[model samples]
Target: MRKNSMKNMRINEEVHRELSNIIRSEIKDPRINPMTSVVAVEVAPDLKSAKAYISVLGDEKSQKDTLAGLTSAEGYIRRELAKSVNLRNTPQIRFIMDQSIEYGVNMSKMIDDVCEQDESKAKSREE
Candidate 1:
């Protein structure tokens, strides 16, 4: 079974939401940023392990610290997942830093700048 199918996507979304809530409400690590979000979740077909991609709305230090804190609390996170979700086997949680959102934001800013420059050039040419 391919990992990108609708079923997998649904599972990923559910896991993402569950993990995000668990991290925010249950995990008491000070390193975690208040604005952290679980961007995506990738789970193995056998459900043995899961990689949780998290995005932190802060500087690099905050992102790194959040990842470190999540890594340290992996065991507890998995335990909580097992207790919350009715899965046959709870996957081991691995936290990874996700920069896709930041990249998208930067890309959008660049596009806007280019559009403004083009508009200015066109106006100059017309004048």
Candidate 2:
């Protein structure tokens, strides 16, 4: 009775794979940067709509441009996905920017800084 069953997981993975391929090789939108990639996809239970998480590796301007490009190309992307993936209904695509990778890197840098400071303090204490 659950919608988030194994079937949904397969569909989500296939959709994510197809989308990543389409965005990387097929899409010609000037707004889409080369660094843009599909991070994940979540399809609704009814399969009427799906949310795609995209990671843009660049400055803020490029990220915005890539999002704009993806938003504009939603229809075409859906059509391509439908053609590539066999499903009863093609889900509407919604592009969302994912910045988790950046956040993680920032956090790692902060942690490293703290560790370095602690090491320096230990050295000074010894001296």
lDDT (CA) for every model shown? Answer: 0.88, 0.93
Candidate 1: tens digits of C-alpha lDDT, residues 35-121 = 999988998776788999899999999999999999999989988888877776788888888899999999999999999999999
Q: Looking at model 2, how many pairs of residues clash? A: 0
Q: Quote the lDDT for 58 in model 2.
A: 92
> Who wins the TM-score comparison?
2
TM-scores for all candidates: the values are: 0.86, 0.93
Across residues 2-73, which tens digit of lDDT does each residue of candidate 2 receive?
A: 568999999999999999999999999988999888889999878899999999989999999999999998
Scored by Cα lDDT, where does model 1 land?
A: 0.88
Off by over 4 Å in 2: none
Ten contiguous residues with the weakest lDDT in model 2: 1-10
